[model samples]
Target: MAQKKARKAESSSQRGKAQKKKAAGQAARAATRSEEVSGIQAFIKYLKEVRVEFEKITWATKKETIGVTVAVLAITFFFAAYLGLVDFSLTKILGLLY
Candidate 1:
């Protein structure tokens, strides 16, 4: 009874391996037969798809865009001024040490 069960398991394992090999061979053949698109053509198609998708999106108005841009610029200028002050102070201290 044990030998019978062992034989059954061995047979199933062999069948599984055979099925897997058949699938792998079929996949390799299909891949070799598949037509490949060029990178530029694929990129252009992707961009067109994205543009259409963006058209579906509701974006902020020009006024909102301008407001956000101005706020970002103000924050940028403030950070730049702060960094410049720190840099100047450090440079002055280093100069005194020299």
Candidate 2:
């Protein structure tokens, strides 16, 4: 009868250990879920901040944009022509030397 009681106690102890391990696993999973939720919340907050900053920007008007674009194109063309003339002149001088 004492041996039977010892066996029952040992079995109960093992079951208790298993239950504790299961609880620990559940707690860890809960912590992971909370961290995931907090990460998503932080990303949403960052996006909201970006949107607020975007609204504060001063965008150029269509007329100003067109004027700036035209100025840039004109300057680009002028530089391209100047560089082409310089390159041609250098090539002719090098040819004569050779």
Candidate 3:
């Protein structure tokens, strides 16, 4: 009878330890979730501030904007043409090999 009581006490102790471990895990998860939420909120706030600053910025005039756009387009076309020529040369070389 005493041995049976001792076994029951041992089982209860193990159950207590498991419960403690589970509670600790839950607390750790909550802490991590809160930290993640705070980090995301901070990032969002930073983006909002950046947007506001951009709105206050003195943007380029329409003439300047058009000029910049045209320049970029021209540069893009030049690079595309350059790469296409390179690719064509390589293709020809490989074709001769086969």
Top candidate when judged by TM-score against the true structure? 2
RMSD of each: 5.2, 11.5, 8.7
In candidate 1, what are the lDDT values of residues 1-98, reduced to their tens digit?
A: 99999999999999999999999999998997676678998899999999999899988999999999999999999999999999999999999999
Write the residue-wise lDDT of candidate 2 on 2-47 in tens digits. 9999999999999999999999999999999876757788899999
- Best of the candidates, lDDT: 2
Give the C-alpha lDDT of model 1.
Answer: 0.96
Q: Lowest-lDDT window of 10 residues in candidate 1?
A: 29-38
Off by over 4 Å in 3: 1-55
List candidate 2 stretches off by more than 4 Å: 1-37
- Which of candidates 1 and 2 is the stronger one according to TM-score? 2
After TM-score superposition, the amount by which residue 67's alpha carbon in candidate 1 deviates from its true location, in angstroms, is 0.9
lDDT of 3 by residue, 5-28 (tens): 999999999999999999999999
Each candidate: what lDDT?
A: 0.96, 0.97, 0.96
Error of 2 at 7 (Å): 64
